[model samples]
Structure formats: C-alpha cells, structure tokens
Target: MGNLMEPSSASVYDGNLASDRVVIHVTSHQRIDQQILVKWRTKTFIARIVEDQEEWIPQFLTQAANFCGENVSRGSPKGSLGSGTTLRFWIDTWLEDKPFYLLFPDLFKLESYKGCLVKDRCTGGGEFSQWEWSWIRPPSTPMEIQQLLTMLTKIQNVTLSNQDDSWRWNADSSSCFTVKSMRIRLQNASYGPTHWVFPWNKFAPHKVNVLGWRIKMNRIATADQLAKRNISTTLSLCPICKAQNETAEHLFLLCPFVDYLWSFILSWCRVSTQKPCNLKDLMEVHQKANLNHWTQKLFQHVILSYIWVIWKTRNDSIFLTKNPSLRRAIKDLKGTSFFWLATRSNIPDLNWEKWRTFSF
Candidate 1:
C-alpha cells in the first residue's frame, strides 16, 4: 500500500501500511515508478542494485541519461522543446561523447572514424564536423578532386608497372614491354566502366590460340639452371645445332642452326649481320638498329614467330607422328610469319621465296 525506508534493514510492511513505499502487484506498472524509486534509494542500496546488474546497467543508464539530458538541454527559454530536436540532439551528443574523441588526439587519423563518416553522413556531432571526419578530405573544386584521383591512379599504374609479375615474355628481346595496345572492334557489345563495348564472347579462335601459346612460352623454364647440361635435361637436345647445350641461349641464338636461321632472316630483310650470342643480346642489337617504327616492330614479330615455329617443330618431332625437314621447317616459319603479319597488321609485301633461299 505504501513505500518506507529503513536504514541498514529491509523495510517490512503489512498490506494496509500507509507510506511512500507503495508496492504495485501488477507487472505492467512495475517500471512506472522505477526511476523515482531508484533515486530515493540509499547509496548502499543503489550500489547493491548496480552490483546485481552491473553487466547491463552502464549501457542502460548511458542511453537513458543521454535521452533525458538532451531533452532538457535543448529546451528553449521561451518555447517548448520539439520531439525531433530532442531525439536528434541526444544521439548527436552521445556519439560526440564516444571514447574515440576522448582518447585520440586526431580523430581523422583513425581509419574506423574515417570509414564511418564516409559511409554515413552522420557523426555523433554537427553536419560540418561529420563532413570533416570523412576519409577523403573535401576538395576546393570538382576539378581538384579529379586531379587528385588522376594522380592517385597514375601512382597505382606506375606501381603496377614496376612489379616483377607484370612483365610478359617478349620473345624477340627476351625482355618485357611496359605497355601493349590491343585494337578492339565492337559488335553487339555494351560499354563497361573502363573499356568500350566489344563482343569478347565471340573472340577469334586464332587469336585465342596465339594468346595461349604466348602464355605457355612465358611459363617455360622459369627456374634457374647452373649449366647447359641442366637445360638439356628438359629440352632433349640443342634446338639450334642438334648438338652441344640445349639452354635457352644456345637454342635461340648460339646454336649453329639458329645462327644460320638468323643470318638468313636478316639478309632477307636487308638487315646487317650483327650477331649476338644470346636472345637478350640479340634484342639489344635490334633495339639499337636504325630501323623505322613499323619495320622494327615487323622484324621483332617475325623473329618471335620464327622462334615460336621452331619450338613447335621440335615438339612435333619429339611427340607428334612426324619429323620436320629443314626445307619444310623454313617454309613453315615463313608461312606462319606471313600469315601473322597479314592478319595482325598491314605491311609491305614479304618475299618468302627470297627469304628461304639462305642455307643452314
């Protein structure tokens, strides 16, 4: 019937007791006076209650206290407080009071805070503060933002260029090209974020086959070898001379057979005989040559095609049901190079018969 306080003892009352200690038997009204009753309790009693529910009390009190404090603080001296302002200000204040701002000297340095503000326009603070907390600082103009993005993208591209894995196996030079341009023609295609609309689904079978061969060549003999003998174990015999070492250098340039092929190709192209001992060195010679742009690329492609064809012929002899004759091999190399050029580029007419006249 009533509430009563007893110091250092539990207050016991009969059903008819008349005091401020009103006990409501109904569960629905238990929370009605809980706040007032809690405030009236002695410090010892409050501590005991806190101890009993310490696990959840802190969070509960924090939220409730924030809601009440904001409602009270935002009340105008001459006007009633609005529901929206009370709710908004409460949440804003609570967020501003979060431990991050209290502990850290620079809130912008924390990735979590930056990410949060970037994702949501809300900070436990004002709108201006929220904007300031974003990971990307506001640019002076749209152009400035674009410039910053461009600079960052350029840096990323440079980083990728410098990475070892980015290099492709450029057979002509036995090195890599920093960039490659691929011509794309679109048919019944849609645009992507970066590239134009092209029917990639309908890729040319020949091109796919060529690409596969390139990838395979790039992966071949990646491991380091101490001697030419180690190379011979992998490649049966010297691809050039069919004698001596079968290492990459011997197979490509040093071997007598390859030396003969190089001489023949160079003479046919009307290029000087400046022989190099290995593919790497041969490429350097080609690079330094006073050849026109198209001519240089054409020559490089021709050399690459020759190497690829030679390797294919070797594989055919070893695994396939046929052996390649010198005359047939030369013909195959010339034909393959011609077909590649015809399909991939427009070039001066090549005289294959004249090219093949050079002997091994």
Candidate 2:
C-alpha cells in the first residue's frame, strides 16, 4: 500500500507533545488502515471520551481499556462532576475497577440499549434520583430492585458538569501519556516469577537504577558484550584492574579492584566482606545482613551506589583522566550514597557522622 496518509489529503499536527500524539484529518473519500486505526483508537480514545463525543471503541484495545480504571481515570476540575456523554453507562469502568456489566450482570441483561451512553440514561440535571432508565421492563423482582437501589447509592455523588471531563493517565505525574510510562507499565505486566526482578532502590538516582537494571539484564556495553556484537576494541581487559577481560560479572563484582571496594563497603556497613560468587549473589548480599527493613534497604542503596561509582570510575579511567584511583572510587561511592540518602530518603538524622560509621 502507498502510504495511507500520503495518497490521501490530510492535515498533520505538530506541537510540543506531538511525539506522544498524532492528529490526521483525512478527506471523506480516503480510506484508513485498520491496524493504524486500532493503534490510534487505543491512544486517542481517552481524549475522545473526555470530549463527550459518542464513539464505539473496540474492546481489543484490551490493555489500554483495562487500564482505564486502574492506571487511567476520569477526572474533572474542582466543582465539576465531569461529563459522561462519551463514556458507556455500563461498559467503561468510570465508577469502579470493573465495568457495571461485570458488577451487575443481571441489570446489564435488563438494559434495553446495551451500549447506551451515560448521558442518554441520565436525564434530570445529573441527579441520581432522576435516572431515566431504558430497560426492557422496570425492576419488578426484589433482586433487581436491590441492585438498582445499590447502584443509585454508589452513583449518588456523581453529577455531570458544564465543563468537559478529562482523562488522567496515572502512569505519568503530569497525567499525560508518554512512551516511557507505557513501556514501564508493559514491562511490569509481562514480568514472570522466573524473571529476575531488578533490585530497585528509591534512594538511588534513576540513572543509577537504570545502570543496575542494565547490568542485571546483561545489556550494558561491556567489552565482552561489545565483542559479541562484532565491535572491535583494541583492549578488552578490565579498564579498572587491567586483569581479566571486561564483562559485567568481572567489571562490577569479581575484579580485584571491585573486590577491594566491596570489602570496604561491607566493612563500613558492619557486615562480613565475604566474596560474592556472581552478580546475583552481589545484588542479594544486602539481604543477608541481620538488620531491620530500613537498614536492609539502606544497604542495598550502598551496593547500588558502589556499582554506579565503580562503573563511572572505570569509564573515567578509560576516556576522561586515563588514571584509575581506588581511593577516588571509594570516596565517590561514600559521597553518592550519603547524598542519595540525605536527599531521596526519609532519614531525618542521616548526617555525615551517622552515615560514615553505618550508625543509621
């Protein structure tokens, strides 16, 4: 197929958030691609729903649709009830996690218009008492009456507003959709029991966590990984120790230089500096300590800081200063750990003295 939008006359939008959003206004005679249409609907349906426009969104946008109640939500400004014109009364999870169809299956079966919009059923100035039901028959049975009354109680506070409704994408703080947030969400969803969960510490900077994650995934461009990719390097030895060929395992955990650094960190944390067998063992070292939850977390933070500092020191030795200082790396690790805890952690009394002697 010639480009779907190219052959047809359409206007394209370019804006600040344009990377996350694509708007194409095509001529009436032009055809739209089905796959592209699905993708577009998946991303843009929330915005359409917010605009109070009735549109039939496919259920196969399953992940996105499922997140409508959990990761995304209908929101309105202060003193506004949010419009419900576009949201299906019994389909979309505007009120709760599961849609009303699942929540009240019997009532759903009674609904005359199975796919009616919220605005269609709500007639009296957005009051729960004024619900105009399009049912095959009014609730005659006791169970049906009880369900209707329960539903009324649940939606008593809900009211439509003159102002337009808004969709909040909870994945991002700004409540706007981003590729990064979506990727993280999908990754978390796909994680299995066998999958190695990255030891994420909130006290460490995001970059440090990313590096740790990369190391765990064997995705970092260490010398061995580079060689595997058929990239030539003049020297593939450990940049810090100049001993073994640089790999994630050796560079971060097994190198003599790194072993000494780990020893220093362990001793400072008041733990025995037993040599870790592998990267996994090194990561789990913090958990072996007989400490409280907070202390264990702090120890993990220290370990992550050490790895981050060691990687930086190795890089600087190769590219920047061309000299590797064990003392400098140790100093950087302590400073980074202290700074991260003081700034990112909730430790109110985490001063240099307490941090220096593992007294937290």
Candidate 3:
C-alpha cells in the first residue's frame, strides 16, 4: 500500500546533471515548509512596498503579489479595512472580498483620483463615518447611480478604528498563520488526475508502489520532465535504447527495450500481453487478462516489479555507465517479486519454484 505520507523532492539547480540528482524527500513536512515560505515572501514583499515605496519592483516580487492576491481574494489571508492606509481604495480587495474597481467599473471610470487609499475617502471616524467620493463629474447614467447607491449601502454599517488595517489568516480556526494550518489547506486544495486513482498493491513494497505511482503521475525525473522543470541536462536520449528522449511514458511503457522486458515478464506470468498506450493503461492491463482474482493481483504486482526493475536498470545505465541488459532486468524483477510475495503477501507456502513457474 502507498504510505500516508507523499514524497516530495527539493533540489538546488546548478549546471551539473549529477548535482541536480541530489534530492531531499521529507514527506509532508517539506511541502508545508514550501507553502509557508511562499506566504512569508508575499508578506515581506507587501511590507517592503508599504515601507520602501520603491518605484522599481522586481519581477519575482510581482509574481509573489499575484500569487498572494489570488489566494488572499479567496478569503484565506483576508484584509480587514480599518483605517485602510495600506489598501488602495479602487484596487485592493477590501469590501465584499473584491476591489471597488471590479464591483463598480462605471463609477471607477469617473473617479478623479484613481490612486486614492481607503483612508482618503472616509470623512469621519466611528459609526458616523461617511464616504466622500471624488468624481470628475456627477453620476449621469442609471448604472453609475445604481452602483454608487449599492456601494454606499455595503459600507453603511462601517466602524472605522484609529488603528491601521490588518490582514487575517482565515485558513485556521484562530485566524493566525501556522505551518500546520497552511499545509492542511494546501493538502485540501491538492488535485489529482480525474480519470484514475492510484491502485496501491499490498504485495509490493512501499518504495516500489511509490515508483509505480510516480510513473502513473508522470512525476519521475526523466529528461523531458527535467527539461519541463527548467533543469538543463546533457543527456536527452533514452540510456537503454539511445533512440528517444527519456520521459515517464517513454521510459516505462513506450520504450522498445521496456516493451521486450514486459513481453518476457507477461509470458512468464502465462498472461496474453498487449502493449499499453500509456502508463495508466499499463497499470490496468492485468485486469483485461482472463485470470482468477489471485492470479490477477499477482500479475499486477509483477507489473509493478517489472517497472521498478526497469527504473533501477535505467539508473545504473546512467550513473555507472552500465549497459542495460534484458536478462539482468528480468532477473532483478523476479528476485524483487519473489521477496515481496514471500515476506509481504498472504500467498501461502510461496517458494522460488512456484514463483518461477507461476504456480502460486
């Protein structure tokens, strides 16, 4: 079965391919740290903008703003308009979880001062406070008049404090930012493939099951995947066949060498095998075979073992400069499945003899 904890890889990219392979997997903790770091960066960037008042902003900070803005508007890190010195009157999301410009586009067009803050329009403090709107001309159209009246009604119960505006983290019950809360929120927001749920084989080891899941999710670090992550690599072609650029799909399912290995394994299992179009299809191919439930599950386990062996061999080819041998891979696949069944599975009296002949 797959572990309750998911695997995450963190790497600092230099130029070297070998250096890029130094990954750290810390289960859920690392992802939580990453999410917290993003929030912290956004908070820092906003603070700097308020204090420094810099004219030139960096591209990364702009990205942070957009990321923060989207999440903030979702009512997580919601801003409360107190004195509203820090929030823009028209742009910042202060009222009704949206900016005034978005709520009243026609009225916003007629505003004489576009850069006015929330504090700029409030006439007085406390419950008697009123909005002092500045317009280039008075509202003439029906839509503009209606929008103004609606906006006024929204702020009718206003109670402005002398204190400055503040942001509240609504992701948690306490309205405070914590790594655990943020991580849970992020986990809830996480999505997977709509069509398939990962079939965790109880017979396979966790690492092997994880490998199969990664292959299905296309999360493996093949050349194409690395390129997509903007990591430069010297090698692009498959180490085994030296024919096509390495990808999860190509390496696991579509590669000619892998196809032959699958044929060998399936033939050994006494199952009629047809080449699957993708990793998802490959994972489910055992179900199409005419076998008993025990044999079907065992067939699925063997498939995962085969995939794990292929990946191990591929890694060997890349790192040790070892040639990929079909015999060695099949041998490794057999050994792995044998160990898994003997130790992990409920298959009674499983031995190497029965395993080799598909007698179990």
Candidate 4:
C-alpha cells in the first residue's frame, strides 16, 4: 500500500466537486435565482406597458424578461380567495387541486376559457357581489350532472371571506417555500410521509429497529402527542404514574419506570449517565460509552430493545389494562436483545450467558 500517513497535495476544492454535481438541481429551480425572481416581479410592467416593445426593458434584460412569463406559468397558485380576479380557474392550481384538468378531465375539455380567471367562473364582484355556485354549461348526462354536483358540493361551502388570493408552497405544512423542503421534493416527486431513518445495523431485531426509527422521528403516539393532534383523551398526563405529561422522551427515559430500568441496564453494561432528555441523546448514549464501532453497534441494538420493550409495557398497561413491573420489562428486553444479537449478529458462538455478563 502507498504511504498512508503521507499528506498528498490534493486541493481543498476536491470535496467541492460533490456540491458542483448539484448545479443542475439548483439551476432547475428557476424560482430561487434572485435575477429570475426579480424578473418575474416586474411581469405586470412587461405585460401592460411594454407589450411588443422589447426595447422597453434594457437589452441586457431581454432574455430575463422573456423567461419570467414561462416561470410564472409553471408555478401553481394556492389558497382561499376573495374577488377571484387574480385566480385562474383551470390552468392555475386553485379549486379541486392538482389543476382542474388532472382531477376532472371531462369538465376541463368543456370550459370555454382555457386560462379563465377564478372571478370569471364566480357570479359577482359587483360592489360587494357575493360568490354563489355557478358554472357556464349544463351537464350532458345524469352522470355528468352528478359529477358536477359532487364537485360543487366540495366548493359550494367555499364562501369568499374578502381576502385576496395568495400563493403558498403546498409541499410543506408551513405553506412557505423553503430550500430544504423544495430540494427534498425535487429529489422525491411522489413524496409521502418523511421516511423513518432507522439505523443500518443488520443485527438489530425488527421490533427494536422499527422502535428506533419511530423514536428518532419523534412519532411515537404518546399521550401528549395525541392531545396535540386534537385527539379526544380524558387526560394528557402519564397513564402509568400520573406524574407529568407523557411524551416519548419522558416515557422512554426520565419516568420512574424507565429510570430504574436504565439504571440497571446501563450499570450492567458499565455505562453510567443521567436520564436522556430526547431521542437523540438516547441513541447517542451508546456512542459515548467508550466502545469501539462494533461494540457500540451491538450496544445500540440493546438500547433500542430497552426502549422498545418499555414502550410496549407502557402500551400494554394502558390498552390491555395489565400491571407490569420494571423487572419484568427488563427481563423481556434482555431475552429479546440477546436472542436478536445471537441470531442476527452472525458471531461465532454468541449465547445468553455471555450476553448477560458482557462488559467493555
């Protein structure tokens, strides 16, 4: 092998090549470029005043001015509206979502104005003209009529509230355009729930592996989480001891039940620490245990099993109305984790006796 310790003369820009690979990705997002954003902002000036007058804009900005219309056409508008003057009924992503054509192809073909504004479809903007259900053509068949009526029922309740139409980035919950969310969507078109980031450890049990994924995502349906989602629950407090609000972190780490469990488990492995405050801390405890990567991974599975078993015990106590001792849960974890490591680790001769008395 070549001299491993020798410092070669590779430039610092070597790593930058990875970032350069994404240039095509960034350039594809025309909405983000400041020049393009500015160009689109002055679309009205181009449309009304500078119509057919390329010289009106400086010669240098000709291409930018031209690109604005195309970019604006690409972006779909979202939100509830007032005088639907600015909203496009069909081409723009307004009512019924994913553009009217994609949702109801039949109605899209019959519409007179391909680029008709939302106001054109609505009845009145005269002084204080209230919005009512109105469409131009009567349906040809009973099926078409039923379709129209069904589509109407969705929007009939949509009475205008005197608010101007506003655009929103529908990709995220905040409804604001964010770079990370945009990049993630660009990376995944058919994006659904964020994929759970479970560990790459092959030796971890299925239950523990899935539990780690859920915990990392903070998606465990603790009582506090249920309350946040407006779920009807009699109490938000810990169902076990009724001490504090039951969150994943509290239940998995700091609760009186887990406190004793962790004390014994950590002490068994000679890893000492206070209660972990979050999922991250719990996961990282193995890394900080002064162990090598191999041992750390083994410990990670054990820790995951610890959390998973505790969660299961908590759920059983609540739903099945059963009483569980910490000792029982700890015993369950030891058995499960040992079994998993033995079968999945592919170690030469891993056994329960060795696992139970494992140190360093």
Candidate 5:
C-alpha cells in the first residue's frame, strides 16, 4: 500500500501525513509502536472516575484490556509507613513483594476495615520513619490466633521505617514507572514474544542490541540522515569507504569490505545463503536458512557480531584516526562474539580455537 497519508480523497488524515509522523515521533516517546499500555486502572483513576468528561474514560478498559484490579496492582511498596493515611492495608499494594491481602487471605476476609490505613496499625505516633508496627487485634478463636501468629512471624523480620509507602515498578532496575515497561510486563504476564526472545539469540551486548534496534527504525545517524537535518558533512561519500553515499544498507552491506566479512561468516557457519542486501534482510536470512534453532542462533550471533564490530571500526576510523581494516575488524569480532556467546548462551562447548577456525 501507499503511505497512509497519501493524497487520497477518502483519507482520514485529510492528506496531512506529516502531522501523523510528527505525532508518532514526538508524543509517543515511551511507546514502541502506536499502542496503549495494558494497565487496567491506576490510583489516579479513582479521582478521574467522577470526572464527567466523555473522552476521559479509556477505550481499552471496556474493549480489550478490561478492568483488572489485581493486574493493575503489580508494584509493591518498599518504604515503611510515615503518614500512611493514603495507603490502604488491603486495597493499595503496600507489601514489599505482593499485596498483604494476597499473602493472608483469611485475615483480609475477617479484617474490620478493608481500607485500613498503615498509620492506623503502627505503634509509635510519629510521622518519622522510625515508628514500629505492633498489631494485636483480638482474635475470635484458637485457629484465628494461630493465623495471626503466622502473619506476625512472617512480618517479624520486616522492618517498617517511617518513610511514606511508595510503589516500585518491578519491571525495570531503576524502579521507575514508564508506559513501555508497564506494557511489556503486562504483555509478558500472559503472552511472550511470538518469535525468539532476543535478537540473534544472545549474539551481542546490550549496546549492540540497541544499535540494531535503532538501525531497524532508521534512526541511526547516517550521513544521509545528517544531511537531511541540515548538518554540514559528507553529502554522498561514505565515512568508511568514501565511495558511495553511507546508508544503513551500504554501510552494513554492498561495501567491498563488508562483502569480505560476510564471505568469511557465511563460509564459517556453512550456511550457503546469499548475502543480504539490507539490515532487515540480514536479520531475516537466518530464518530462511531452514537450520535448527541452535544453528540459526549460531548464525545470528555471528551476523550481529559483524554488524557491531563494523560499526565500531567505522566510528574508530572517523573519530580516533584509526585506519579501518577488514582483518582487524574480523579479529575483534571473533573475540567480542566469543565473550558474549560463551558467557550469555553457555552452549555448543566451542573453544576459542574452534570458533576462530571454520569448524562449523
């Protein structure tokens, strides 16, 4: 199909495709594609529920991602009670790992107040973080007392500081909230990736994966992209070859140097496939090779290593006055790929000598 905003009489965007691009690039910073997060409802939704605005209500709530209270309350509170008038013992997610109610369902059912505040159950009466929790709720029977004792035993090691209860997003290491992370967690909770988990299945480092992602999105700072942005640099010459215009296609493929590298890699893996013409083509060539999962993963690692090492060498040439050579790059690629594959994958039991040689 033509571009979505092509000058069509029946186009919904009124033939203004640039506006669509602008909205996609600028507004949706956290989103991968133009998609909504799967979180059913947030604490902010409680106040917004009373707002009479028609657009305020999300379409996904009733259509696709229905109201799921348990799904929405994934983050657990780490800090102890300060002035926990806002934190509910059962409703809000206050427990460090899972919700307290989920941990002790019997207590949750028999509790007097479902929305009991953390401050209401603390021992000391200070807004400081040093306050201790001492709940001796009157139990009805011996079984209930045992349940209470069990709950207390579980909580004895848990030290409650005077800090205010705050939710931590468990998806990321930073414990910060982002729509992308929330969506990834929710999506993976019930559904995982339809394909391999990682690109090339543990071929390169985190930075290389990031570079591959940017290359796929056409966001890498190629000479053409720079010229388009009015930056003064080579308009047609490649930084590496200084022959043709540098593009994702030419930089990674079609170049005589890359052709040599691919020749070595393909012969090494014993995969008799044509060299891919572009980044996307290179990424998909392994699938078409019809090898088993392990062999395909092996080829992917090599291809990913090639891309990363080439890019790094190209950068070294440009910035460090280091002359780029195919032999040096291939050597670096071998060492780097071995470091990644050996540590990350831990399979095939291939040594450095075997990996260096064409021992496929």
Candidate 6:
C-alpha cells in the first residue's frame, strides 16, 4: 500500500500497480463530494428555499393585476373598490346618469301620480301589496294590523264604487265592492234570517255535493240507495208525479208540471226545441241555441227561478207547511225572474204588456 496521507502523483502505471488503484479510488471519492456540494447549493437557493412560494406568488400577482385593471376601467376612486358608499354611488353615478325622465315623461306627471297613489289609498289592494308600497304603513302597536284591516274594510263599503253606476266594474276598478259585500253577507249583518236557508259556508261549485249534504241532513237515503235493493244505478220513480220513475231526467225536466211551465216560457220567448230529459241534456241544448245576450240572460234567470220555486215547494210539502199550488209556484217563479232581470242594467225592451198579460 502507498503512504495513506501522501498526495498521489500522476505517473504511468502497470496494470496491476497498487498505488494506481489507490489514486483511482481517491479521485472517485472527490468527484462524489463535488456532486453532493452542487446538489446542496441548488436546493438551498432562495428561489427554491420557501415552501409553496413558486406555486402561490404567481397566482396572487395575477389576481392583483386583474383587480387593478378592473378598477382602472371603471374609473373607480383611489380606495378599495368594496369600501365605497354603495347607495350614494348607485343613486348619483348610475340612476342620475340615465335619461329615464325624458323617456317616461308622464311617469312623474301629477295626474298619473294621483292615480297611482289613489289605488294605494283605496281598499281592495291586498294587505301584502299595500304594505310593499308603504301606502298603508306598518302598524306600530299590537293588534293594530287587525284594527287597520277592519277599518279599511268598513270604509270600503261607502267608497267602493261609483254610486250612480253601481253595477259597472272595469278591470282597473278597486276590488273593494266585491270583498266588502262578501264580508258583510258572510257576517249575516245585511240580509235577514229568512234568507239564511242555504248554508253559504259549505256551498261550492258542485251542485251534487250541495244536494247530497242537504239529503244527509234530512236523514233520508237517496233514491240511489233504494235502487241498490234491486241492483240498479238509476232510481226510477218521480218524486213529484210518483207515476214515473224518479230518474233525474223525469224529476227536473220531463215531469208534466215542469214540462208545462217550460213550454209556456219557450213559447213566450218565441224559440222552439225538443224537450230535454236531464239537466245535462238541457244545458247542451241551450249551448247550441243561438240566442242574443238579453234573451239568453232572460232564459237563464227563468230557469234558475223555476228550479228554485220547485225545490222550495218540495221542502214545504215535506215539512207539512202550506203546500204550493202549481199556479202559486208559477206566479212566484215569474215574479222572482222579473225582479232579477229588472235589477240588471242591460235588460232588453221586451213587450212588458205581453209578459204581464201571461197568467202565472
């Protein structure tokens, strides 16, 4: 072995020389140390020293640049964009700059303003919409909301519509009339006790439902139940005649009493048609008939009056009250029909003498 601490000198060596072998090993170790120093320096450089620096700084700079560009484009004042007086900016810088006044000249006109404000003050503007407009301000005290609503409703009756033309209602008219009328009737303060036969609370669109409830209250099984004894869907025995089966067709339309009344009315109206057997078939025929508005209204009112009189007469007989004569029933129907027609503003100029001449 060569002296371990002695510097190895460059010299040509035999292939098996030990000193040559030692020199080669020393050179290899030095090269490894130099590589390690280079690696350490590369890792310690400031660019790579901080964790996440390379990843986060570029993103932050890019966002900052974009924000600055946006601020410059909008001509924003020299402060944080989010820290400005938002309401002031909106009113002054945005709204004031628009030409809205020029485009909507009538919008600020006194007449238009009066109309808009009048609607707000009037009744029938629902509570929610009224509240939104601040027309009817929020109540400050407990139960004030209810009190205000009540007062508003009461005032509605006197100021709801044009008194001279009470029947007229345009689309823009206040809904006060309808609402107040309904509320008073529902409270039963306006109409008398004699008018309270129909249960207004339970009344709905379905005629059968109304009649069914009435039937239930009387504790009488419908004709359908009687028919079930013989496995039939139809009840065959006229409630009025007792000579004919009480099918809906016979009871409402084809019975002799009803047929005679209907025939008289049709002849008076100067219209002719085959008689219908049921309510549905009657309605279908009426739909096909080409009648003018006044005639149609007269016919409808007549039909309603007839039905009402018949039902009332039936109830009277069942309750053992004074039984209705055919003549009396017809008289009541005609009077009621005429009263309803006269109330409508657009009643036709019929031959009043001819109608009055017809004996009930």
Models 1 onward score TM values of 0.35, 0.49, 0.54, 0.52, 0.48, 0.33
The candidate scoring highest on lDDT is 3
Error of 3 at 24 (Å): 32
Worst 10 residues of 6 by lDDT: 163-172
Span of 10 residues, lowest total lDDT, candidate 2: 9-18
Backbone clash numbers for all candidates listed: 5, 0, 0, 0, 1, 6
Clashing pairs in 2: none
Tens-place lDDT per residue, model 1, 1-360, is 123232212111112223334222212232333334333442333344422332122222333323333322221011111211222221222222332222232323423343231114333232222222344444445555555455334323111111111111111132211101000001112222323212111112355345324322332442224242265344456544556745556556666666667777787676774776544444444455678765565565556666676667656765684555666766776777766655664434545554345221
lDDT of 4 at 20: 10
Of candidates 6 and 3, the better by lDDT: 3
Return the top candidate by TM-score: 3
Clashes counted in candidate 1 amount to 5
Model 1 compared with the native: what TM-score?
0.35
Once fitted onto the true fold, the runs of candidate 5 whose alpha carbons sit more than 4 angstroms away are 1-200, 230-236
What is candidate 6's lDDT per residue for 1-360, written digit by digit as tens?
122123322111111122211111212443344334323332343234344333222222222222323321122111111212221111112122222222223322312232232233444433321221232344645455554455445334322222211111111133111212212222332222232333221111235335433432332333554565655533245545557755445556767877777777677666666776545445344444567654554454555556566666655654565545778877877776565545543534744454555322
Which whole-number lDDT from 0 to 100 does residue 116 have in model 5?
A: 71
RMSD vs true structure, all candidates: 28.6, 19.4, 14.8, 15.7, 22.4, 38.5
Report clash pairs, candidate 5.
129-162
> What are the Cα lDDT values of the candidates?
0.39, 0.66, 0.70, 0.60, 0.58, 0.39
Candidate 5 per-residue C-alpha lDDT over 251-352 given as tens digits, one digit per residue, 9 for 90 to 100: 888778888888888777788887776677777788878688877877777878888998898788787978889889878988888888878865676788
Residue 25's lDDT within candidate 5 is 20
Ranking by lDDT: 3, 2, 4, 5, 1, 6
Q: Which candidate do you rate higher for TM-score, 5 or 6?
A: 5
Clashes of 6: 6
